[model samples]
Target: MDILHIVGQQRLEGTVSISGSKQSAIPCLAAALLTDQTVVLEGVPEIGDVATMIEILETLGAVVTRQGDMVTIDPSRVESMPLTGAETRKLRGSIYLMSVLAARFKQGVVGLPGGYAIGPRPIDLHIKALERLGVSVRNEQGVHYMRVDRLVGNRIYLDLPSFGATISALLVAVFAEGTTVIENAAYDPEVIDVSTMLTNMGASVKGAGTDEIRIKGVSQLSGCRHTLIPDRMEAGTFLTMGAALGRVTVDNVIPLHLESVIQKLERYGALIEATDDSVTATFQEAKPVDIRVFHYGGFPSDLQPVISAALLQAKGASIVVDKLYPQRFRHVQELRRLNARITHEDASIIIRGGETLLGTEIEAPDPRGGAALVLAGLLASGETTLHHAEVLDQSYERFDQKLKELGALVWRETI
Candidate 1:
């Protein structure tokens, strides 16, 4: 494993280009399994999660080749083998293979998904949605086995607006025989991105970016070239860092996807300006603000910890709450090591601002939690040794390189 070596109190200012959306890229990668023709994906971020997905694709005998950020996947020789081993457990998106495999092969076997131990994600929705589509699903020990005598389209009403469930239903429904309607679907931009790509691949999908989605089943899908949407999480990270440090400009970001975060940062005392594809953040005196995480069109739950950490220097107290994952306060203890006054009360993290953070060695709990530690490290007094920081690469593409580009004194070394 590698650790991030950071010299604190060095301002990271300048422009940083946001990479491809990790949320969008993975599903689009999984969608390739539905076709035998070649699928070319541009702007795919070079991140750990994407790498793991590509590795799984290769393990299934998909001929995958890469050139810079562009990935060409030919599933012509792919097999619906049982998904197991370290690769499956390394990424939570491994379960996404279930839909495409079930659609194309009528049977699929996969191990349970793995990701940050923040909280229990409702994967039952995925199984339930598949079952509603006339698929037989059962779990033996931990591995899931799914099979269908015949593919038939059916209506699926998600209990929650889960992004995974909506996309899973869409993937399987595309190959079914009849029309399928999804109610209370997730409204994330990634859902729209996946639908866009699936449409390009000759699938008929409608109302992707809404609570209700209608999918007319097609006999087969062909591959096409699709460019992924810009990553909003990575874009929000730059804005958070800029608010904590100095002026920063994040390019290649879609302002509409980050509307809630942009508004919140403005309230928390960061001078923000946005054009079509760029957002510039300038440091201002920190101010206390309350943030509540909701689904898309709301404050992103993924950035809860990072934003909480950035607000540590605010003039007053601030509250960061996540209804989606209350246990996300795992970073609270790590932040306290740097003299941060924070309290975890159930679903909320109360941050007491105005305390000078002292640099020291710290361990990251998860990806976003690690991001919180990174911001705290940059704000600390001296050098901060960040251990177990490799988890940050799971979502952040070339993190240390991007920081160095922005003039931050940061580097990575093997532990």
Candidate 2:
């Protein structure tokens, strides 16, 4: 395993360029399977989950070539095969393939998805939406087998606006025989990016970044080139890091995507300036504030952990409510190791700040949790050792490198 060692209380100063959206790029890779032509994707993040997705693509017979942040996927030579359950277990993004494969090959098998074990992200919504689209889905043991004789578009309502389910529905409905309407769809920028990619590929998709999505299905989809948007979560992470350390100017970011985070951070007394494509955050002091994580246009649940780290030095009491993932407070125990005063009740985490954090060895339960640990280390008084820190690769590429660029003393040590 690899451990990350950080010498805390160091001021961070420099401009860091945000990478492309890992969330958006994963679905785009799966959507490439919807066509038989060559699809070129630019601005794809070089993250571990993406590499795993590319491996899944190649395993299923797609000719994939990568250079820097660009990936060319040739699906003309693709073949229908049961995706390896073990491989699918490596990434929760692999569930995006269920809809693509069912639409393309009429039948496929995928195992229970895995990624950050933040909470139980059940695929019931995905299954329900797919069943509404005339697909027969069954779970045998832990694997899901889905088949469709012919997909007929219909209105599908989601119980909640799940980003994964919305993207999965779009993938499945892109090539259906008629129109498909998705109500209470995810209003995430990533969803809009996928919709835009499908539109560029000649699919009629509208109402992305809104609660309701309308998709006029087509008989076929052609390949096209699309550039991914910058990752807002990564931008938020850096911003939170800035709140704990010193100043961080994030480049290559779409300011609009960071509206919720910027609003919250500013409310908590962090100095933030946003331009068209960049955001600069300078921390003065941490202020206690209550945060509620919601769907898009709200504080992202993905950013809950990092922000929690930022709240460690808050003046008073702070409460974090994560409705999306109730068990997202996995970092609480690890942060406690750094002497953070935090407690939880159900889905809410209460943080009492004003404690001087002393660094100690801790473990990262997941990617976001790992990031929170790193942030805690940034504010702590001594050396912090984070175990299982390599999990950051799942979403972030060159995270340690980026932090080092910002003047943080971070290094990877294999143990």
Candidate 3:
């Protein structure tokens, strides 16, 4: 396994460019299958997940070409095949393939998706919504098989506003018989980006950034060029890193997408200034903050771990509740290994701040939690050695290199 080593208590200063959204890129790449024409996506981040998605696309017989941050896919040659293989099974993003394939071909086969197990994300909602669109689904062992003679649009309501399920619904509805209304849909920026892409592909989609999304089914979709939005999660992680020390300017970010994070960091004594496309964060004498992870346009669940690590240096007590995924506190235990004063109680993690962390051996289990461990190492006194640190590559592109550019004393080693 590869390990990451970091020497702490160093001030971070410099400008770091945030990458394109992994969340947006995955679904958009899957959207390429909705059409047989050429689809060009710009600002695609070069990450492990993107690589996996590309591998799946190629296996499905799509022609993929890359240039710098741009990726062009010719899905005209795509053929429906069982999305079974080591690389295909390991991607949670593979679930997005289910709807696209089902829409393009009459039937689709896929196995259980793989990724860092943050918690249980049951696809019952996805199955339920697809059934509403006249698709029959069955599970054999760990694989899912779906077939439809022809899809007819219907009003579907998600029990919870899940981003993945919402995107799946949109993909399926694009080629359905009539109009489809999605109630309690996810209002994520990624969701909006998908809707915009579909619209660009000559589909009628409206109210994407709202709880209710309406999609008018069309006969066929034509591919178009689209640019992905900046990654808000990456920008938020950098902001949290800045809260520990020094001034760091994060460029190529959408300020509105980071509203909740910027507001929360300000409450923790971090000075944040946002322009239309960039944000600058500076550390100060931090104070504890209480936060609860919620849906999009609220405190983001994906960022809970990084903000929790920032709260470690705060004065007094801070409480964080992960209403979205209770199991997200895995980093609390890893932070404990570094002598952080944190405890888990039920759905919430209570953090008593003002504890000087001492670097020690830790583990990076998942992408977001892995990022939290890296942030903790930046504040610790001694050397912090993180095992399974390669997990960060799943979503983040050039994370260690970007941190090093900002003057972080970090390095990766194969061991």
Q: Which tens-of-lDDT digit does each residue in 176-287 have in candidate 3?
A: 8889999999999999998999999999999999999998899999989999999999999998898777898899998999999999999999899888888999997789
RMSD of each: 0.9, 1.0, 1.0
Q: Model 2: how far is 142 from its true place, Å?
A: 1.5
> How much does candidate 3 score in TM-score?
0.98
Q: Which stretches in model 2 have alpha-carbon errors above 4 Å?
A: none
Specify the poorest-scoring 10-residue window by lDDT in model 3.
111-120
Against the hidden reference, what TM-scores do the models get?
A: 0.99, 0.98, 0.98
lDDT of 2 at 243: 65
| Model 1 agreement with the true structure over 41-119: per-residue lDDT tens digits | 9999999999999999999999899999999999999888999778988888888899989999999899998888887
lDDT score, candidate 3, position 339: 88
Tally clashes: model 2.
0
